[model samples]
Structure formats: structure tokens, C-alpha cells
Target: MTDQKKTHQPQPPIAVSPDEAARLAGIGRTTLYAALAKGDLPSIKIGTRRLILVDAIRDWLAQHQG
Candidate 1:
């Protein structure tokens, strides 16, 4: 009998600060903040770090793309 093992590769997590998120989304930081304020853009506030999920950003693009 032989044993086999499978290996899984990990993908880097997509993380961005407010500034980077604004740049990546092609929007101003104010607009981003406004959206967050209005609960339009989902964000997580852990400790003092606020993070928006990359997948959420992608979904936003998918639904809001012009």
C-alpha cells in the first residue's frame, strides 16, 4: 500500500487602508467614508484598524460597474 498527500496553496489576503481602497476603487476618500457612514460599504472595525473585505469590494464593483 502507498500513501499519498495533497498540498494546498494559499493565496495572499487582499487588504487595503482607506487611502488604498479609495485608489483601488477609483473614488475619493471622502466618498469612501461617506459610503461607509451610510452603510453602503461594509467595513469591519477591529481595535483601531478598519478593514473592508476584498471580496465585498469585488462584489460592489460587480453590481455597480458602469
Candidate 2:
């Protein structure tokens, strides 16, 4: 019997940097920062670094539909 190798693909990141989050949310970095400051967009801060979750961006868009 021949051994078959299983290939694994890396999954997309669940957490992203502020710049990437802004790009994904289709808004400018300044606007995103504003929203974050206003508590509109939830963010996770780790050791003086802020990280945005992909799910949070999607949820924000869903709840802010015009």
C-alpha cells in the first residue's frame, strides 16, 4: 500500500491589524480609529497593541446597514 500525504492549507486569520481591518471594512484608517474611539467598533488590545477581529467588522456592518 502506498502512503498518501495529507496537505494542509493555512486558514485565514481571525484577528487582523487596524490597517487591515479598515481595509476590509471599506473605510479609511482615520474613520476606523474614530469609530474605535467612539466605541462603535469593538477592538481587542494586547500589550499596547490593538487588534481587530474579522467577525467584529462583519457584525458592525450588519448592525449599521442603512
Candidate 3:
């Protein structure tokens, strides 16, 4: 496959840290945690860490972007 194709390929279960998730969501870490605590954000427990699916996040943004 071409380099561009590789770079453009869909990600499978993108894992992000709390800090990175906050940055991507345009909120502070505290706010991110607050949402998580309130069960407002989508997440899954992977092993010991909490993970947010990239497809979920993308769809969320698309909804808001419209």
C-alpha cells in the first residue's frame, strides 16, 4: 500500500490518556474527569485504564459540527 493510504487508514480502537482526551475534547482535565464521573462521556475499561473509542468521539464531533 502507498504511504498516504497507510496514513489515511482508519484507526482501530484509538486509546488516549485522560490528558490527551481532554485536549482533543477542548476541555481541561478536570472537566473531562467531571464528565467521566457523571457518566456523560463514553468510555470502556481496558485492563486497568479507561479508554474512549475514537469512532465514538468522531461521531460526537460530527454531530456537534453540524
Candidate 4:
């Protein structure tokens, strides 16, 4: 019998922190905050933590990219 505990797990991230979202979007922290402050980007607040959806970030990039 083979144990499944050694298997690798792969899961797609549904949400990301502002810093991580910035990194993925190739933008600075300040710019990411600015977008959030300006309501240009959408985020979900869980308690005190703010999370940005990966899908939203992609859409934002598509809208802004020339």
C-alpha cells in the first residue's frame, strides 16, 4: 500500500495580500495602495486583513494596459 501523505498538493490562490498583489502585477507598494484608495481596485476585508482577488488584479491590468 502506498501512502498519499507524500504527494504534492497544488491549489490555485483565490486571494492575495496587497503586497503580493503588487508583486504579481509588477507595481510598487505605493501604487497598489493608491489604486485601493482610489477605488480602482477591489478588495475583500476579512477582519482587519484586506485581500485582493487574483481575478480582479488581472482585469485591472487589462483595463489599464495600453
Give the local distance difference test score of model 4.
Answer: 0.97
Q: Which pairs clash inside model 1?
A: none
Q: After aligning candidate 4 to the native by TM-score, how far in Å is the CA of 45 from where it should be?
A: 0.2
The best candidate in terms of TM-score: 2
lDDT digits (tens) for residues 1-66 of candidate 1? 898888889975676677778888898999989888888888887889998887777787677778
TM-scores of the candidates are 0.71, 0.87, 0.60, 0.85
lDDT of 3 by residue, 1-66 (tens): 656543577754476767778778787889878877877677888788888766656665565574
Question: Model 2, 1-66: lDDT tens per residue?
Answer: 999999999999998999999999898999999989999889999998899899999998898898
Question: Against the unseen true structure, what C-alpha lDDT does each candidate score?
Answer: 0.81, 0.92, 0.72, 0.97
C-alpha RMSD between model 4 and the true structure? 2.3
Candidate 1: regions farther than 4 A off = 1-12
Q: How well is each residue in 1-66 modelled by candidate 4, as lDDT tens digits? A: 986777678988999999999999999999999999999999999999999999999999999989
Model 3 regions more than 4 Å off: 1-13, 59-66
Lowest summed lDDT window (length 10), candidate 4 = 3-12
Give the Cα error of residue 39 in candidate 1, in Å: 0.4
Return the TM-score for candidate 3, rounded to 2 decimals.
0.60
- Model 1 worst lDDT window (10 residues): 11-20
Error of 2 at 47 (Å): 0.6
| TM-score order of candidates, top first | 2, 4, 1, 3
User: Residue 40's C-alpha lDDT in candidate 2?
Assistant: 89
Query: Which scores better on TM-score, 3 or 4?
Result: 4
Error of 1 at 58 (Å): 1.3
